[model samples]
Target chain A: MSVKNEKKFNVVYGEAVGAVAAHSFGEPSTQMVLRTFHSAGIASSVVTGLPRILELVDARKKQQSPIMTIRLEKSYAKNYEKAKQVKAQFEEVLVKSLLESFTEDLKNVTMLLEFSKEKLAQSDLTLKFISGKLQAKFESIETEQEGNKLKIKYKSKKEMKSARTMFVNMRNFAIKGLQGIKKATVQQDDDGEFYIVTSGSNMAGALEVDGVDKEHLYSNDMFDVLKVYGIEAARNMIANELKKTMDEENVSVGFRHIGLLADAMTYGGSIKSAGRHGIAGNKASVFARASYEETVKHFVNASVFGERDPLKGVSENILIGKQINVGTGRIKLAIKKEDLKKVDAEK
Target chain B: MVVHEVLSESEAKKVSAEYNTPIDKFPKILQSDPQVIKIGAKPRQLIKIHREDPTGKYSAYRYVVESV
Candidate 1:
């Protein structure tokens, strides 16, 4: 006879999300050095640094000394809290000047946007005059085809400068709003508001304004998301330009919401993303324009060639050394042709 | 191994609430490295948490049965 035993059971799960955050590394050529960590299944990666030295020989039994190399990287951690800490440290060390760059970016983008509007206004004078002739019921937009002799499909419609102005201003506002975003230590309030209070303020009084819901807090409020993140792509163009400052400071700005960000940056312009046709797709290299493709290729080729040492193999090994593989291998096994015949006869 | 037939934050919170289970009460090893895990954690991921809660004792367990 047997008795049955019972136990209780329950079910549960964990939540995960894709994150956009800045990363850092202790050295350059960090990838190879960090591959070992990956081998052990750790979620960390390194990019660009050298483990060995390079030497040059000018002449006369003399060799040049090797130069020191450096590496920089952004590391990703599986744990969000841990990742946030590393991100905070990286920004403190490298991204301090981002605030100033963003301000300059806002000014530059504003100027460009104004210039574009003026050019558009001047080129379509005839359309502007005809736009008033159209009836208010039509409320139609006047189309003109004048730039580079391009043809306009609307032969009798009118133009709306106010609409254009609204678009431009919205875009500009969006640009200015996005300009001051920096990746650093983000503090989360008890109510789940996220704010990045860096060492300095890029927005001047914007950060100081008081409210229950402060500016720059990504509270996931739809209005806040729209006011800040959902800005027109012009804001992104300005933001992209501002990122050059990060480069100057030896830092990097991670790509924001690449879709809406691109859309806003290229607003009243072009739509670019990865599909059958995209702006980046036209470029053959696998990276952005500023990335180092040629330098990377040259270093890789030289390192591979050095290890092989083709010149030394043929000239030194073949010519200077005795017959190679003599002990391990032989021209013929055991006996020469003449010696084999004599040995057979003796047997 | 804790098998989750369905996984969600709300569900995890609900189940933890029902049972009053704490995070530290589960069969898990805590370490600072996060890279090294005990209790069948694979290389890429550090550990497998059973969706434990801080107020594990707050949850309650209940069952129903019919007698012939």
Candidate 2:
């Protein structure tokens, strides 16, 4: 009895689950706005809506703003000063912001860089550090520091125009934080626990942070998650992101539907979108391929390759005006009364 | 060892044959599902699950399914 009850919950015969899943996700998505404004708060303010869903389904590698939430060791997390220090380390201090004024001496072909005592202290930088990083980055660069002021002179005789660009580049140089991470902030939760949140993602580098809790660190970038935690974790992240996005829109969707979408996208051992460049574009059935997008291209390609459509899928069957093999259409019956009479005669 | 075991290629074929339908038509479990991973099941591979019936009248019950 239990076995029979359990079997009843299974997918019905000939159910076109793929089409159903698509519709289940699609209808609700139409009500969703093109882009939802970022809600300001401690939580991830990443945009949610159709654009985000499209990006996730496409399995894009780079997101608009890749943010990382770095959980700290309990000892550091409990202390406010320690959390500040950790956060400070992740905050990027650009060289340009430190300068009080920039002047280029065209006659001497020398770029003058000056800094105030308070600005240097606020930036947590010194003349020596700035000069050293600059010298390392450029060839034949000379630096002279007199107190808080630093003068940069290029050894090259030509290219006065390139001097301004060089000065701009040097001014925007990052003096603190890991490369690619633009900003970092310290946030306190309801329990008064503090953690570092970053504007850009660099999981591998974040793991190296002294007080970072490696296990608890997470980033919004799916590709980074895939790179750091294998395909399984990446698939879960995609599914969860999809659900979360929809939930924020006050839309309800079955997890199984989103899970199926994720599984289909990741079944090939990697993430692929449901778009033309990904899973749907690579279908084996010629009719199925033709039904998606670029009907002529698919038809031409199939003809060139002599490809055959077995009409196994719902799309192709529907195109051919056949009963789609789903629900009742999936079932066929064959009965012969003459065979029963023959069996009775044999008996 | 995993709590469930994934069916081998031949076993998956047999399970599909018993269902009298294509593998895709069956209920799905993600390849990343914890049990599927524990059993080292890949996509399209079937997993055999054994669970103890809560009623105790039927102590042993099993189900086989393909991983998505």
lDDT of each: 0.28, 0.74
For model 1, what is the error of residue A76's alpha carbon versus the real structure, in angstroms, after optimal superposition?
33
Q: Give the per-prediction TM-score of chain B.
A: 0.29, 0.63
The CAPRI class of candidate 1 is incorrect
- The digit string of per-residue lDDT tens for model 1 on A180-236 reads 232335455454434344332223223233321232232211122222322221223
Candidate 2: give the clashing pairs.
Answer: A14-A326, A14-A327, A96-A171
Q: Candidate 2's residue-wise lDDT over A153-205, tens digit each?
A: 88767587787677777787777676568888889998889988899888877
> Each candidate's root-mean-square deviation in Å?
28.4, 9.0
How much is B30 displaced in model 1, in angstroms? 52
lDDT measured at residue A187 in model 1 versus the true structure, 0 to 100: 51
Model 1, C-alpha of A19: deviation from truth (Å): 29
Docking level of model 2 = incorrect
